[model samples]
Target: MKKQELIHLHGLLAQVQNHYEEETGNDVEHDEYASVSVRPTSIHMSKDDHKDAVFALAAGITSELADEATEQVPAAAD
Candidate 1:
């Protein structure tokens, strides 16, 4: 993907994180992402930096969702 496209995706993921937190009243634990200290608006940063941030952020968000999914009980079909 182009650098601009990657940055756009990064921004979208950040918005997803914010929306999830707002709805659930819980924070997305993106420790690795935080360590990178790269924001979507960090246009001065390299493409690789944004790529790393995107992966870390996506992993954190998906991990949380996966955990939540596991706690639910699916209905049995007749």
Candidate 2:
């Protein structure tokens, strides 16, 4: 992919991650009724797995971008 396209994709991925974080954030101020509660532990592969997947995907994309950038750079002669 072109540099510009890679940059745009990276930006888009960042936005998506930011939005997901916001959505999953604990907006205490927005809560009308606040109460102390303990988080439940479950054997579900939904939340953490999903975030891990996104991070893995982003890392892969970033690696690809770096590879592309290096390919575009001319190697120096010894």
Candidate 3:
């Protein structure tokens, strides 16, 4: 992946993480997944690993955020 694309994906992941924290009024603790932690800033990886990591992070983040958003919505009953 290109440098700019990596940067953009990193930004999106970070933004989603931050949004989740702000919405729930808590700081996200990313103590696990050391690779993920260093991802946004620097991901010491090969080209394939870099692409895989970014996609994995994006998928995970999107799923978590979607779950949170779903919980916040009100359901209607007939």
For residues 3-71, write the lDDT of model 3, one tens digit per residue.
Answer: 667766766777887787788875544544345444665655544555655666666666666666788
Residue 37 lDDT, candidate 2, scale 0-100: 17
Once fitted onto the true fold, the runs of candidate 2 whose alpha carbons sit more than 4 angstroms away are 1-45, 73-78
Better of 1 and 2 by TM-score: 1
Please tell me which predicted candidate would have the highest TM-score against the true structure: 1
Put down candidate 1 lDDT per residue, 1-78, tens digits, no spaces: 989999999999999999999999878887999998999999999999999999999999999888877896879999
Give the CA lDDT, 0 to 100, for residue 17 in model 1: 97
Better of 2 and 3 by lDDT: 3
After best superposition, candidate 2 residue 58: deviation in angstroms?
Answer: 0.4
Ranking by TM-score: 1, 3, 2
lDDT of 1: 0.94
Please list the C-alpha lDDT of all candidates, in the order they appear: 0.94, 0.42, 0.63
What TM-score does candidate 3 reach?
Answer: 0.52
Spell out the clash pairs found in candidate 1.
none
Query: For candidate 2, what is the TM-score?
Result: 0.36
